[model samples]
Target chain A: MVTLEILAISMPISVLLGIALGTARVYGNVIIRGIASAIVITFRGFPVLVTLLLIFFGLSDFGIYVPPFWTAVIGFILCSGSYQSEYVRGAIRSIDIGQSLAARSIGMTKLQEVLYIILPQAVRRAFLGITNELIYLVQYSSLAFVVGVPEMFAVTKTFNSLYFRPVETFTTLAVVYLVMISVLVVFFRGIERRLAIPGIELTTK
Target chain B: MNSNIPVLKVENLKKSYSGRIILDGVNLEVDKGETKVILGPSGVGKSTLLRCINMLTLPDSGKIWLEGVELTNPNTDINKMRQKIGFVFQDFNLFHHLTVLKNVTIGLTKVKKIPEEEAIKIAASALEKVHIPNTLWNKYPAQISGGEKQRVAIARALAMKPSIMLYDEPTSALDPQLVGEVLQVIKELSTAGMTSLIVTHELHFALEVANELLFIYNGKIVEQGPPEEVFANPKHDMVKKYIASIYSRKG
Candidate 1:
């Protein structure tokens, strides 16, 4: 129930941050893209354990004492945003150049062209990546225990400590994650198949 | 043809790619309501020349005046100038995701800032002019035939009410049977006195429709006159050789 509560709070924030940053990376100019690149490298290059330890312990030295749940949410949102940015960039770039040209030929301003023509196609292309990231979010929700937030994995650990049966506790947790992820995968695949364009590629991968 | 200050004029046009010239110092003029066809072999810069008319290619050096407005000036509003000049590409270049009606209405609403209902009304008339059925308006480009796609491309351009239409090998991508259908649409436009510059390989269509024909070869206008004089009299050796090559291929 703690993990479920954490996911309910953090998942939407993670997705929203991912989309906002990912969109900027794709449409932003050279300097903006460079900055976004640096942010992504810093977040993704460090191990999640190192990031959590730094956020929880190192930040206290700077007189920045963050609550455990908020700290976990911030860390996960940054990590998820970095991981998903590349997928969005690839999807936005993969759209046919002709679409933009067609929009321009019709007298669309650069802003209008991006908002009306380019973004719609790019969003469709990015849906599969977004779905994959959702699965990663579900799995990564387990990592919130490192910050002492007591998510699903934390619940299993407590159960194991009480019962002295680690195998049974972890086995049940594994089955739960599996069922949840499979349900999400099937649901997304159906949506993708229905919205798929005839000529354009369905996935960048 | 009405010669009212030459609705479209090209002077000393030149285009080059990596030090190789494609349109080398070419000059031409089109009076209002005249259909001028630029005939040439592939790679002779026919498409590039037409592209220059709307600043799409940005000619290396040249001056194009449309309706007395100088296009070569850097200060010129290229978007406004392009809005007045319509272009049909060899590949159709229709938006694959957009419906035929949307494709036509896009320019009207976006460029002209016309109201949506008014734009739709204009697009409908343009589509009707191209003889595309109103039933096909909602279809995507992938669902349409090459001929129908080209017609939509034309309608998209015509929605702007352009003063001159530039066609770059409009029927080249169509099947042999479908080529006639697109050419017929163009022929109707020509008869309606729509000013046009067409770069085409269809010698017979050029002969039948063009008031003036230019035979371009080796990046130069090797022959220019009425189609009958250039195709029949054969003053230039290069022109004769090209006609013979085309005939041999047909045979």
Candidate 2:
């Protein structure tokens, strides 16, 4: 339960971080983009288990005793944020250069242009990628068990150890996770279909 | 009165991209309310010239003055100068996310700070001028035909009510069947005495509508005069070769 709450908090926090980093990767200057890319690649290249251990255990060695739950959440967010940045960057680039030119020609400030014109279009483009990332994140929640936080997956392991009925306990946990992701997939697909630009084909010929 | 102080002037315009000269030492002038057509062969920098005039493409070196405002000067206010000259792109760069009405209204509302009600009213009239029905105002760019989108782009420019309109091959991207409607809309604007600088390949249309014609080649004005005089009499060998090629194609 504690692990689940951490995962839930991590999900939204990381999504927001992903948006920020992704937007920077797409629109920032050379130096800012370089830093953002380094952060994204560094987090994504390493294993989540290693990352969690480093944050929860390694930090304790340095005299910092932060809560294990927040540590897992931080590690998960770093992992998710990197992947999400790629999605946001790809979505923003998919938009036509003409759109930005048209906005600028009309005297819109650069920030105003992005806020009113580019972001709306980029958001619509990024929706599917974000949904896919959500599915991935739900699966990633299982990694929280390595940190000794008793979420759904960790709870099942405890149940298996106590009852010695590992098969039935693991099966139930797997089914619960599968059902949750399936529902999320269906819900996001509906939103994607409804919110997509009308009559505008997403695929380029 | 004082020759009406040419609404636009370009002197010694020079531009190059990666060692290739695009607009090399070009010069021209357009008086207030006169329609000027720039005729050029493909890749001769006609569009680049227009792009530079609007500051859409910065020139390496040049002087561009619009409505007594020095556009090419380092001290000039780009946004302010841009507001006074509405540009119509060849690709009809309408905001794909916006409806025809919203595309037309955005600049007016956002840049000019015009009241929403008044901007909508102006947008409606501008669309009516382009012959796009108010019923189609809510339709997105993807829902409209290329001709309709071009007209919407024109309407978007018109809504700004700038001192001049710059058209870079306004009808070039249209299908053969759809070309006439956009040309017809531009024809109507000519009679309104609006200052217009058009870069186009429609020779007959340029002859019929423009007060003066400029023939550009290799980023310089090779020949220019009243359309009738330039077309009827050959002054330069390059101009003669160009005209002969077009005439032979028709023959």
Candidate 3:
């Protein structure tokens, strides 16, 4: 339930941040592009464990504090959002140049072209990449245990220690993770079909 | 609007890509309701001229005016100027994700900010003008034939209610059998005084519909006159040879 809580909250935030940064990197002016690039690089450069640790402890340097669960969630969002931005940027570049030309010829401003023509196609094409990111989020939620959040891995560790049956406990953990990923894959596949366009490709893979 | 001022005009238009000149000092003017057809061999800057007039391909240095308003002025609002000119591409360039009706209405709702119900009504009439039947309104671009796709592209541009239309080899991409249908639509539109500038290789259609025919070579209008006069006389060697080559291919 705690894993679901983190996933449900952080996934949407990460996806939203990814879209804004992706668009900024592609279409923004020089300063905005530089800022977006710096954000993506800084977050992606650090290991997720280090990020969580920094968020949990580093905020104390400024005389502010965050709980372990919230820190884990924030860290995951920053880390995952960087990768999501990369996928979104790649998808945006894949749309043909002619699409923008047509949009401009129809008197659409640069912003309107991106908003109406480019982003809709790009988001659809980014669906598979986003779904992959979501799958990773499922596994990364386990990292919350490292920050003392009583998520699935923390409970599993307690159960193993209490019963002294490492193999059974760990094997059950693996099965549960497999089921979680499989359910996500099926859910995304249904939505991808609904979003599919006749002549456009969402993803080749 | 002054009746004497041309609907579209270009002065000293020039452009080059990678130091290779595409348009060098091309100039022309089109009054309201005048149809001028430009004919040239491949890569002769004919399409570039149309694109420059539409400001799609920005000229390195040039001037364009629409109804006496200077479009090439640095301070002009380009999007607003573009709204007054309709451009149709060779590949039909319809929004592939949108259905045919949505394709026509998108510019209306999104760019013009017209309400949805009114945009649909405008789109319906525009589609009808291009001879697209009611049954195909919901079809996707990939689901339709090349002829139908071209007509839908025309309808998309026509829905803007532009003062003048620019066609860059609109029929060049269609199959031979499908070319006549698109040409017929262009002919009908021109005859009804749509005020168009067309870049095409279709000699018969050009001779039939054009009030004036221009032959461009190496980024200059080397030969131009009434369609009959230019075709009947041998003023420029390039024009004469170009007409002969096309005739040999057809004969």
Candidate 4:
């Protein structure tokens, strides 16, 4: 339940942030591009656990108090957003340059080009990577236990300590995660198939 | 500006990349309802010249006038100006995600801000002009033949009702069998009095459609005159050689 809540909160935030940052990196002017690059590099290079610790513990020393659950949410968003942005950026760049010129020749503004022409195609190309990111988010939700969020793994640990049935408790927890992740994989595969472009595979190969 | 002012005028246009000159001291004029065909060997700055007219590739230094508006001026509203000048690329740069009707209607609704119903009416008529059957209107570009794709591209441009159309090798990318269909649409557009500047390698089509033919060599207009005059009495040695080579290849 706790894992689901965090995933629900963080997934949308990460996706939106990823798109904005990715677009800025590609199309923004020098200053905005530099800033977006800095953010992506910082979050991607730092460990998610370190990011959580900084937000939850280190910031309290400076008179800033963020609750443990929100800290985990923020950390996941920051880390996943950076990775997702790279996926989106790669997808956007993969589109032919002629697409932009075609839009411009028709008098569509830069914003209109991105919104109507570029983004729809780019999102289609980036769909599989985005689905993989969601799965990673689900597994990484276990890290929330370090911040006292009592997510799935943390709850399992508490149950095992009290009942002293380590083998059975851990087995149930493993099965639960497997089932949840397997369901996610199946659902996203269906979406990929449904939205597939005819005569054109999404694979880079 | 007088009524006799050329619909499109380019003067002293120059461009270079990596210190290599692409177009140097090029000039052109297209009167309203005139069809001018630019003929040249490959890599002779023909494509660059067309791109400059629409500002798709900005010229290094030039004066471009469309309907007497100075397009090279920094303060000019380029987007609005571009709406009046339609361009068709050799590669048929259609939005793959959009169906043919949607592709034609996108500019009208998005940039021209025409209502959807009105835009559809306009787009349908434009597509009809290119002889793209109504059955193919809902199909994606990928589902169509290369020739159909080119016609759809032309329709997408024509839907804007541009004052002047620019075509960059409209037939070069097609299979030989498909070339005639695309060229036929262009010929119809010419007969219908659409002002167009075309870059093409089809010597026969150029002779048929061009009111004036321009032969460019090494970023310069080496010969330009009525197609019959230039073909029968070539003044430049380079133009003569180019003509000979094309005919010999066909022979």
The numbered model that scores best in lDDT is 4
Model 4 docking tier (incorrect/acceptable/medium/high): medium
Per-residue lDDT over A1-205 for candidate 2, one digit per residue giving the tens place of the 0 to 100 score:
6745775798788888888888888778999889988989989998988998888889999999767677788888899988887888888888788788778777777776887788778878877787778788888878888888777888888888899898899999889988888887788878777776667876454
Q: What's the TM-score of each model vs. the native?
A: 0.87, 0.93, 0.97, 0.97
Model 4 DockQ vs. reference: 0.76
DockQ of each: 0.37, 0.59, 0.73, 0.76
Give lDDT tens digits, candidate 4, residues B181-208: 9999999999899999999999999999
Error in Å for residue A106 of model 3: 0.7
In CAPRI terms, where does candidate 1 land? acceptable
Backbone clashes in model 4, listed as residue pairs: none
Error of 3 at B124 (Å): 0.3
Put down candidate 3 lDDT per residue, B50-86, tens digits, no spaces: 9899889889998999999998997999998898899
Taking the tens digit of each residue's C-alpha lDDT, what string does model 1 give over A1-205?
7766666776677666666677778777998878888878888898876777789888999999977787787787778778877777787788777676656655566677777677666767777787787788889878878889878888889989999898888999999999988987898888887776655456564
Q: Candidate 2 overall Cα lDDT vs. reference?
A: 0.86
Local lDDT at B24 for model 1: 92
Query: What alpha-carbon RMSD in Å does predicted model 3 have with respect to the real structure?
Result: 1.5
Question: Per-prediction count of colliding residue pairs?
Answer: 0, 0, 0, 0
Per-candidate RMSD vs. true structure?
A: 3.4, 2.5, 1.5, 1.5
Model 1 alpha-carbon drift over 4 Å, by segment: A1-27, A52-67, A198-205, B1-3
lDDT of 1 at B62: 79
Q: What's the C-alpha lDDT at position B18 in model 2? A: 99
